[model samples]
Target chain A: MTRPAPLAAGISAAAAAGRRAPVLHAEALQLRFGAVAALRDVSLSVAENEIHAIIGPNGAGKSSLLNCLSGFYRPQSGRVYFDGEDITQLRPHRRAAAGLGRTFQGIQTYPSMTARENILTGFHNRMRTGVFGALVWWGRVRAEEEAFTAKAEEIIEFLELEELRHAVVGDLSYGLRKRVDLGRAMALEPRILIMDEPMAGMNPEEKGDLARFILDIRDANRIPVVLVEHDMEVVMDISDTVTVLDFGEVIAVGTPREVRENEAVIAAYLGTE
Target chain B: MLPTGVLFETYSAEAGLLKTARARVAVAALVLALLAAPLATGAYLQGVATHMFITLIAVYGLHVTVGMAGQINIAQSAFVGVGAFATARLSEFGLPFFIVVPVAALVTGAVSVVFALPAARVKGFYLALTTFAAQVLFPIIVLGLPTSWLGGLVGLAVEPLTVAGRPMNTPTHMYYFTLALTLIASYAAFNLHRSRFGRALKAVRDNDVAAEVMGIDVLRHKIMAFFVGSMFAGVAGSCMAWVLQFVTVESFTLFTSVWYLGMLIVGGAYSPIGAILGVAFITLVQEGLHELGTAILRSGAQEAGGAIFAATNIALGACILIALIFEPRGLAHRWQVLKTGLQLWPFPHR
Candidate 1:
């Protein structure tokens, strides 16, 4: 596979650390919207530095799972644990403050703000001062803002978005907007990055570029990723472990090679092979 | 990595008004012109200018609620009435005008938060109707109060505002005072546009769900916007009390709230300058129409002049509808288009 040797070594060390302490754990999660069961006892665990991809058919509840984890939706009968803390009832902002970052299925860029300003918002929770400090622009607030800017610059560089950084997010192309959205999430410096359909509407060339960027982020940051994607080839190529979901139930969970050859996954995709 | 010097230079690049040399010059010109208005204009014109500035202040309040937060509020004139009555009653206790003004604003701001309660659950047209109820109820409540504190329907007369031992009774003095306060308010509003609170308000306006997802307390920002907006309206009403030397139920009527909204629509909702421009334009137009009516009466076209005076509401209604249809964003957008067109002369791309 020609993975960087040093990166592979670092990944192993990170994996060991991750195994010692899992970052996010969900137990017996159940969510219902009126009569329909959106999620039913979907227990899942995400380790600190592992790339976990969640694959599913059209209504398999992948998004609902992500939403529950991020505090957008409160499950009726389950608890979510982050860094060994019970966070089932925490608000989204509190979750963001505690190092959980996510991007939406469609880009949610603040159209009025420039790309830099959009990314700066991701660092809102990290800012030390309240309204007074910001108004005066003094002391700790200045230091915090500078630190955030430096970190944002690093993310912009990593994403190769230097030219697009000054442009308003509303004016950017869809591919560029997606990259900016990812960059914003990275700016949060989250321990766990949850992406909803990160590769939904990209050309092949754009896909290749994004694939490289995703790999670099995972390798460099050692941050675990929970990706919900439709592209089987990209998921198969990059995901360390794959969980196949169908009809709101886990069809299989294993290494990519094992999941690919499973009769059930093939049948779910091809309709009775 | 880019060179340190180059990176620093790029990072320091200013956005908004601070970035543009032309905007700086324009601001300077505006300040100078405002400072000179009292010197150049006559007594009646100065009085009109003072009225215009006070109306501008109230419109700025509407700007915060409608323009920035995207919340519909038609009860701003009721808040203004609250401020006016509060200022009048407080001043009657022999308190200084300066103290009375701010206290009136704070009281009105608190009352505005009370009015904003329904904003948490309702929005758009329904919220507008709720505020409309406030506007309708305000005059009735003011008149129904048993105490003569609010002057009942007869209203109360306000003493002249004295500054530093000098009574500001003349039109020129009132003009200068109103102009100074208006300028300060405008500058503060402009500074707020670049503040985090301003961005939060805009975010909530654009999409409350996304704003919540981004960690913004949508309800808090919405209420804060209402408070700030109401404070400006209070200040304006207090100044109006000083200028008219009286406070009355008729002065801050439901019709006045509609006029303020029309001014904002005509001037530009998003631009602060639009608030001032809209007030000035509407005031001048109404005065000119009044003068024309007076001239026609003198020139033997008495019946036509009487008809025009009686049908002023029709004229105002038509003007508002036409402005909305033709220039939805108001005068500020038109001004922006013109400026941009000039800046990009011969290129023709916005």
Candidate 2:
């Protein structure tokens, strides 16, 4: 696909999905680490097919909220409901199994594994073959593995990683590693894809590619995306709703244009600490 | 790694050990050579080759835990000992070696899980220390027990493996027995790494938190790696018991475990073939040095044998240190790089 032009208006994924329903809900989440509060009464809703962007300055609890929502951090008081079920006490892997996939800002792709193998690891939980079955590598396990590899191949093709499919991921450039991380997350077939700084270090060309991929995920896959990005250009172009955070609290929630015009968001971005 | 011209139409064909027509012929030739080893080689060389097969089996276990899964195990020999002793006891009960092998493997796997329980929480040096406890305690428990039960320091003599109601007394018979198990164990280890469990274990080894986010139970995979690795050790131990016709704490030591780690580093930790190559390299070097020391003493080149023997130990240590400094990824990886370079010819291939 050619690089798509920047979106002119805030085209919410809701518009493409043709309906709106809160698929992921975080209500009154309050998290504290000893004395300092990382998040205080942070509440957010990710509607179906919406690209919800969480923007904040440093120490503004953007990651803290994502952690709580993804079940990495438990809130002191409150719950996270996913698809109408309370998942507050569930573990991170359980939450992931429940269809919440995420990419780490630090790039958590398996370094020693190949680009294709790293993507295949994402489908690990989906396979029913146990260790004994795998050791045997009989018909059932062999079929399961072939099926998973076929799926990984699709992701590899989608990310244009055909040439680098056998290359060790640790040897890949930072931009490529981030892209592989996105592919692995995508392989999880998540109901809600959460990404932290998906374009932190990419050049403009790579950023455009990533932007198009994110749009494809929203438009083609129709999965809701909750992204924490510092790149304002990306936030304004793709995100349907921009939730601005300041001092561990939500300051504004609106369309990108309205968020840009909010007095409180402007003050937090360019005003006193 | 594949030759540049080779390609596959299916995942099964792609993942196959022998992908090309030439590879198939080469593997068949290798199999014929192995099967004909007893006929061509002298008794001593055949014995050495058989021992190599057994060591390769245990090293494959180490490859899984320390190499692939990145879980350090310093008590591999203890698991081997568990198998050996289990086999010695089972054989006395009039069980066949076939039944004895799997039972010993299961017992050893269970024993390894006892030490591996801490692996769920601890990693790296701490995990090694936990396994170290198993290494230290294995001998103590064997020697500390009653002389009649575990045979104490006197050790327990295992009956020679019997085939079709006949005792397998000859070294050639032992060689065939071991080669068969080694092939099966190697096949199992190879398949384990390519399976879903292998992917889960590798994911945990690489970035466990990310693995968890990918919906893998990190603790379960780590424990499974230990269970499977130790079971390989068990099968090796059973073969060892039948070969030596004995079980003794002196045979399985911390040094043996350390040497297994060294062999893994020397060969290449990633592939099962690497594990075999590592065992071959280390065993040949040690045996070759030992023969040289004995020959020098016999030729009266050295006033005393003790000095040359000590030097041999130093030289062995030096070889491992040099290998780490130079080919850190192991011989198998260096071989791949060489092949890839040859395929590229004069041009750089990264």
Candidate 3:
């Protein structure tokens, strides 16, 4: 408990169990904003313990794909399946409750709350104590709160945010806020984490820190990751499988190296202004 | 903000309402003062203190709904009116004040849920307008009823508050009664602030999208805030009924709703102490203005009392303006700054 256990244990266990079922599968998604098509015939799958990266240009529908996957945007025609159960039409909160966790493109935390409180808020679905228990603050509420705070503390320690745990999120630096946002998502203990531009607007050092955190979230925690990213270096380095999109269409999908060397991906990147 | 240089090694210690030993001592002293107040003060002062406590209860509700939950509820006084009428009707059925008060609170809470239902779709100005409709429509509905139903604007007289066959006739007796209810209400509010539900409400308030993704049911929390807030307002309204000995449609006006909100803003909408301080400060200002107007009339200023009575409204407006401009966070933030400065005196505060 002092340090993160090797997620390889979980990965090996998953492999030994011979589970090939995709943790998440999106099929032929078609999303349109009025007359403009944002995603057309886009399909992808994230396996257990895999970090799947979706990379593309500004108008390449990377965000739209993430939105569809997380149930924030309903695809005009598509099916999203989590654990092989169709969830294409579920509401955002319902999806989250069904083990879909996400961090926004813009770092979002409870602004007036402390980092600890913000992280604790992420455990909303976990806590079962009701209004009467909360108002009374008796044995049950205190116990649940203590248990959850300990859980939240583990995440804080994992992220090395001990000093900033009590700091108000509004006053924290951007890098710290991003860490807190990730910590919030991690608090859900989701089977799959969907991050939109997790390293956006970060300096190289901050980006490195975030990239390591993302990898830790995937490898150390053994959680499947679905990321929409712009930083190609981090994407190629950490991503297990890469799906490249261009003009709302999938151009290539393979291992990171395969996608990196794909003639179509090269043309898509070079062809953009 | 705990005392400077303090360190809490446990979550309970850090999250405790009285985090520092100094705060515990201060609260103990305040409770002692509150207990002794009835004996020390005259009837007029006791009456004023009773009013302050009642207003604090209502403001605390507003603080939860508007301040923490980030739902603007202008119809809080309407909820209060609902409570008062509920109390009046229940007393007519020969129920005791203790039973009648809680019934009133529950009734008003249920009524607030009706108003809050539409909040699932509307937000900000639109939501405020929705609650405003409650404020505007409440009196009309109350007055439109037959005279036998809700007194038809003439109002209904509340039966005397009695507990265990003892009539609470004197202001001192009623003060103790109000004090007990206030203590219970404030304790619940304090506990609620550190509770999981309270944190969830804040999360929804800060960013509903993030809250939803974090698995918080935003609409449920918003409506819960309204329910709890109106429940507190209901308690306050029952207290007001006892204080006034009557319930009237005219008493729960839009002006009354505005007054409650102004008190919240002046006190700081985020804390119970802020609500209490806000109600106390505004009540004192109104009384002082009235006293000033009386003195002016006694000193041969013809009709100055009427003008001064009108000037009290102007002064209330000025108080809100000044608080908003100078300390938008309210007196609670000012109190915090002062306390922090004092705690770290002789050293540079970070």
Each predicted complex: what DockQ? 0.29, 0.70, 0.67
Per-residue accuracy of model 1 over B143-196 as CA lDDT, tens digit each: 999656688878988877889878888999998888887886786576555455
Q: Return the clash pairs for model 2, or none.
A: none
In model 2 chain B, which range of ten residues has the least summed lDDT? B303-312
- Tens digit per residue, CA lDDT, model 2, A200-223: 988999999999888898887899
- Calculate candidate 3's fnat: 0.75
Q: lDDT (0-100) at residue B206 of candidate 1?
A: 63
lDDT, candidates in the order shown: 0.78, 0.86, 0.87
DockQ of 3: 0.67
Instruction: State the TM-score of candidate 3 restricted to chain B.
Output: 0.95
Best by DockQ: 2
Q: Where does model 2 sit among the CAPRI classes?
A: medium
lDDT of 2 at B325: 92
Q: Candidate 2 residues B45-118, lDDT tens each?
A: 88998889988999999999988788999889889999999999999998988899999999999998888888
Off by over 4 Å in 1: A1-18, A127-158, A187-189, A219-221, B1-18, B93-98, B144-149, B310-315, B346-350
lDDT per residue as tens, model 1, A28-88: 6799999999888776667767788999889988998989998999999878888878899
Across B102-163, the per-residue lDDT of candidate 3 in tens digits comes to 78988999999998999646988899899999999898888898999888868999988888
Candidate no. 2 TM-score: 0.94
